[model samples]
Target chain A: MSKLSVIDNKRCVGCQSCMFACSRRDGNAGLSNSCIGVKSASGIEGDLTVVVCRACADPPCAKVCPTNALIPKKGGGVRLQKTKCIGCKLCQQTCVIDAVFWNKEENKPVICIQCGYCVGYCPHQVIKLLK
Target chain B: MNAFNDTLSRVLYIDVKNKKFWVTERKDLFDKYIGGAGVAIKLLQEECPSGADPLSPENPIIFAVGPLVGAFPLASKTVAMFKSPHTGDLGESHAGGRSAVAIRLAGYGAIVIKNASDMPIYVAIHGNKVFFRDATTLWGMGSSLTAARVMREREIGTGYRSIMRIGKAGENMVSYASVTVETYRHFGRLGLGAVFGSKKLKGIIISGKQTLQVTNKKTYKDLYDRIYKEAVNSQVMKKYHDIGTPINILNLNNLEALPTRNLKQATFEYAEKISGENIAQNYLGKRVACAHCPTACIHLANLREQYSDSPYFYKTTFVGYDFELLYALGSMLGIEKPEDIFMLIEEVEKFCMDAMSSGVVLAWATEMFEKKLITENETDGLNPEWNNTKTYIAMLSKIVNPPNAFYKAMAKGVSHAAEIYGGKEFALAFNKNEMPGYHTGPAAHLGFLIGARHSHLCNAGYSLDQSLLLTQDVAPETIIDKLIDEEAFRQILSSIVVCFFARGIYNLDLISQLLATMNINYNTDDLKRIGKEIHAEKYRFKCREGFSFDKLEIPGRLFETPEPTQKINKEFMRAALNYAKEKIKCQ
Candidate 1:
């Protein structure tokens, strides 16, 4: 089992390289489908927050899903069962860290699948995969 | 058209007077000019009325991002074009933050804001919907930082947004007012803020989540990885990530090229105290990067102040500082302390003014006061003396609010102030816009005088001076030729909208390769031709706006001060300008 984790988020520069890479994993060139998000924690003068799935063992998002669309993975994160999802957004609401992103065009949840594609793109070495 | 090209060619035109917005397919413009500065100048010519007052509703504001913006590293800058209230001609500025990515993802290669709004408003573009939100409350905000924070709270798309707003300086229509992008970055040259003020626009909030598909996904990914690796590994980029741009302070000071005390002296006596290494070691809080950029070059300094009223209470502020900021607010003012520099930087940031212009203006005013050309009454009882941070801070506010006619004239720029006050000889400005912090040699000044936007970055003459002129004596005509060629080449880079810091990383060959991945096939020769054409077009707009190389005033202080080479003079400068003018005409 493996999980993606922020190594030292203080080093993060809010470049969104991780977010871009996550989106690029789908062979896309934009942020429409990225599960990761980075933004200023306060304003531009303050620190940045790199928001990714925290990989909870007993995930709250899975419990709230009406159709069990969010299947808990072996490590901690969950995999989306697209057939079961009805786009109610219950999983989005229940995710404590707000990591269950949305596909606005498809009205589907875009959860990080713990593939670790973004780890290679973190220029500052702020994120890594724990195996 | 390909999907990428189709999306990249859509231009959003907003008519604030009519409260109407529409998208036009500008594939022809993008096809010809690429995007950013190249496409923006074309749009400006089409929209702006001839000889229109820069602050009038007729002067249009255009923001353009390139095709490489969201897809490539370092392609993070957005080119802003308008008629400058400062220079009264072809106003152009570039800002890096999230602006390029936001504009790109918002599905617009360019956004042209036309006419004046009926009331104070901020335009919010979320995907396809455009909302003109009443910004009456936010209009007179004291600090641009506060305005940006308020806008952040009010707007949607926290993760995917770029908020650009003006502060009191902009709202008051100061000629050198800048539009603060995010909090750390800005369209920090010319009078874009004054243009925003004239239009009654308080801010613009842009955010979107549109997906972009490349012609070849494998190629894009491979190119992206290679570029990313190169950016991180490049020694030049590593220098930026470490000490950032402020590293130039010591180097310039050592070379005796740093403009100090209003160019009265070339080197500051206390340069080391406020050097980049000093700031990074002592005050550096964190480093940040623009969207999609691997090199996190933006350095913010932490200044902790204990409340005088409450002994135990302490407040810390993070102010972005760069080489230009350090030069403009530090050495140029003769300020010896780094903390004082930070304080001045914060005030300038709060006012949303161009730091270079603000510093040059204050330096001139200080010199005037020293010469007894003007009394304290002119400064509203504040004496603008060198090394006095308190007076400078107060003066910064006065420039924004403008208590007296002197402050009003000063707010316009150093050149305007000198025109009225009889200090035109020492007014360090090129074509009415304040000079950037570079007094390297003849080429640097020549670049400032002849460059399309009258900007140092327009051709980077200082870099040329250091690399070429310092090594050997070069003919003025040859220098002009080199400057023209470099400036023309930069037109393509700015169109691609890469941060000039990454100029070495994104050369013509690499740019061609990257564009190939996106299905916009243009070889080096085509790019070279287009670059020259764009440069010519910018000059055409400038000439139409009444700019002339022969008529430009050469600052006497530049000749008096000792640059590294010590060969700069009026005659050589005039001859170079003439040659450049003829060369541009031939082009």
Candidate 2:
């Protein structure tokens, strides 16, 4: 399966290479465009909690999207129709893991499309794409 | 030029006296000098008046990031420049946290802080806003880590902002204290923390978001992909990702270049216990990277400690460790065990002092104590014994707290301490900045003597020493020429604010390509010439501050110790330094 999973969180070093990889997939250079977010657990002192779309069977993000922009794919992950997205940000608030990232410049939601690009950048094997 | 072409043009000016702030467009400066150290030196020269005290109100703190910052990979350092409280001239240090990214995205090429605050404060920047928050509570905070915690909770913006703070030693204006960033990285050397403390500033918080633009999208993408692939495939980069800098412990020990027990020996018998392999095998819990850097070279040790008050309570502390620090706190101080070294580094972190200088001071004290140069009465009834972590730890507390006259002397660093305590022969400092953990040979010593900051990183003469291992022998003139050239080229790298670890990937050709994307035109020769120009400017500042080659001192301890190269002598070092001085004047 192409859907991503946080196999281990403790192994993460807060390198944010995965965040860059995600943004690079969307043709950007900085963190402002990334769909995956890695924030400190308790400031910069403790371990990092890697937040990314886990491709839930019944995604809350998809259900909260009023304009049907976030539709579930044939598999598990949700597909985004950019034109239909009204930028309500309701979907972003609904997700428990806060995986629905915002495109600050475009004012649109950046959802993971089940691509395994970021998994390659996680040197510690923290992120995985599984069946 | 348009705003996009002039991306690195904003300069934030903070007058700490009135706690007032303003911004000025410095495109004229950045256009000529580029950013980071290049721009920082110029700003320092313009902002700081001649004959001004390093700890006075006129000493301006200049922090700069380059054009490649936030726009390119591994160009992640923010260069800091001021009058050093340690050396009293041409202070320079660089830190890689979110600092470079935050400042760049906040739309400033450099930040200049002048005058001293009447009250303690920390600067908080978000977009164009600068807030002077009261830091009276944070001034005497037990550790820099706790202060960072309080500021982190108070500051806005997450996932991107940087929190830089000082600890008790800095508050006490200890000359070699450091300003720690993110609990791991630092504006680590040459008294940046003391400068911060002198200004009644506790820390700084920076946060912003402004997307970087490129001249040609396709060219940018192609170059980015090429560099990314090169960085990922590089064995050098992979090595950094694996064990980080602690990898040097075994290599330097094998070469007998690792300075141990204050250069009494070149190799530590217990090298393996504090090695990168050992750390990776046992305590390496995490590996963090600086902003926009794929090479996560920062290795943090996970130390499990039970509470002294409660047997059942345990806390796992993450302590960042690297080669220089491990050599300084571990081998040089005669701490054999990894846990003991980690604890020593932890103590250093708590006080926010320079690890290299701290270790040098302690070793000097220990050696003097052993030679019957001083009594336990001088050492506050604690024996200054090598390999005794307990005594060392107690001495470290005294160095920060400075409970007695001896501790007060130690707080000033090895040079000043030796000046007071009669260990000038074994002071182990160059131009007031303590020597790094390298006993390679003459080129290393010469580099320290002639280099702008007298820092090993200023001109990596240790590498030159190791190179001589294969070539057998070289003329002093040739060695001087080589190091001068290295220093000039490193000026450009620091101007670009790229981490020196990625020096292999960001070669001249690649650097040229990256600059082209940013709309600056520079070929290899142009880059080299510009590098020399920057070096000349920095030297001009140093000279203006009354630094001269004639006044530069070489510690007698260097010649007394035999190293791997075994080429160190007063005659060779004198000639090499003289040659470098002449060459620098010509440049």
Candidate 3:
């Protein structure tokens, strides 16, 4: 079984420290390349939702990839092959969770690799690794 | 590297006396200070001669942003450092908006302005070029809001532009003047606005749009999304977004730490009237946000009321209120009416004064009146009363311009006024800077006294004291030790230009990982070592300016008023000071 990044929204402070950390992990100092999304409901923030790839057994993103760039990994989830991607965003539009973040600079869709780097930065114990 | 390629291109050095501009790329300084307040502090220490008059032409004004500013999320604050006209010591303030982004994108890490202009002028920084335009028309502007509106319309920049302009208070050089950015947010502490005024610079307008570079693009995207998710969904930011900082009122009131009626008492008698819940229920009109901030914690409310003089008339005014503003201008001034507090806040904003200091000054004036120090004659025939928003507004306006002796005295800040009037004991200031809202325990007071910059966040001593109260009998030494450690750690965070709000999220291990990604090598031990060094450097500057923690005045009122942990003893406080002196000496 492949591990997935799990989120517990209750403990998050919305500092965006995790976001910066993720960007730094990629050798960037900005947020343009992050794959996760956090948005508050209405103007109130008590109920914040953390959205990330669910790493499904049968991912919808893989089915919509025209060039078959997105292939299911041996562990459990799907992976994107940048060389095969035609800059087509059909998979991005089809992903129900909106986990795929599009990089405007590169014209490519970014998805969470299920790496646990972000988990340690979450001060609230909101993010956990799930098997 | 070309000026365009290097992030630390060149510090724009402007000598106000000759109105000359020059640039020097201090790469070594950038590598060490890492820009923002860290760089500003170094510049202040080097340029500002000892005992240089803070309001004189000799005083240097510095504006700085970090290396990661334009390239990152949450790295959005521009730090302004100067010799405070109020504190007579190290003065530092930070404001968020498009200021940091604009400065960084404009390709400079620091802008230092020295000397005074013979006439009013405004500075415009466009890429590599700098222009100083005559602001004869904009001078003596009564309202900063109007100035910002006019500048926004006239300047060739918008959206990503930042306008930092002063109002009547600044032009008049009020001791606690603040520079307002984006019309609402302010670099609102010490007297940076006064420094601008001293330079005969009415305002500064900056704008830029430059794309930042990133390494390991794939990993960057993944991390960005992860952080954005947590920021938008985190419970820690919920309170800030919902009630804004005003929520601290309820929490502090419950803790019995709220400074009320000029620190005469801990909790206010009419605490409910000024609680965040009350303000949100009655007057929370709209919420605004800083640039690229997902939290949107800025709350501006409209208070509509029927005018007593007009038959069928109503006045609608927009006011921003938070915990510190409410505590300082409302309860601290003995004003219980929410509408009254809102009205006073509007007056402060219009004149562009530091709300905290203004409130403390008003409170001191009110106390002076009650004690019969000065009568109606000294007050220009206007009776100084508590909670009278109408009278308070009138007094504030008169003081900003100061047409008479009473108004002029009031303009000099509470500490100076108290010194002249012989009430230093209850002047309510730390290092000549007015106190913030936290008057709950020894931790808060001690933190303010000992913290390098004397800011609430330096060590958040009040919060520490509260935590200690819950756990065990916290000895004075334990409190001092904890505060020193926290303050040291915070120095490292600020050097990295990380916001204090994210302290919990950016632990030592996470910081190490993040730095690794940036190709900067550091570990937990490195952070501690660096933090200690930064803390020591700040103290070194403080000592150079003749600051002694042992010589620090512990206001007599603190001993009289019982705190949440119980009334602090003088002996214990003395012992704590002695220990702090030794600890600092060892550093």
TM-score of chain A of 2: 0.93
- The alpha-carbon lDDT assigned to residue B352 of candidate 2 equals 94
Residue-pair clashes per candidate, as listed?
0, 0, 19
Looking at model 1, residue B556 earns an lDDT score of 88
| lDDT agreement with native, every candidate | 0.89, 0.84, 0.74
- Every candidate's DockQ is 0.83, 0.46, 0.09
Per-residue lDDT of candidate 1, residues B169-228 (tens digit):
888999988998888898977989999999999899999877887888888889998899
Q: Which stretches of candidate 2 lie over 4 Å from their true place?
A: A55-91, A106-109, A115-117, A129-131, B1-6, B306-313, B453-458
* Residue B539 of model 1, lDDT score: 89
DockQ of prediction 1: 0.83
lDDT of 1 by residue, A1-115 (tens): 7888888888898899899999899786988889998977887676778888988999999999999998998868788999989999999998878899988877899998888
lDDT of 3 by residue, B1-587 (tens): 22324455369887756878888988777666556666778888888898888899888988887655655455567778888787777777878756776787676788999889999988888666777888888888777777776776777644446788888888889988889886567888687888888788888888654445544456555655554565567886677778888888888888888888888888887888889988898888766545445565667777787889997999876687778899999889889888888888888888889999899888888778888987887777777777778778888988887778767877878777877775677778877778888876778888888887554334668787777754567778888899889987876666655566666655777666554444445778877877777677677767777677756787777887777877477887787778888888733
Proportion of native contacts found in each model?
0.83, 0.43, 0.14
What's the CA RMSD for each of the models? 1.5, 2.5, 8.5
lDDT of 3 at B346: 83
- Measured against the true chain A, the candidates' chain A TM-scores are 0.95, 0.93, 0.89
lDDT (Cα, 0-100) at B535 in candidate 3: 73
Ranking by TM-score: 1, 2, 3
Q: How would you class the docking of model 2?
A: acceptable
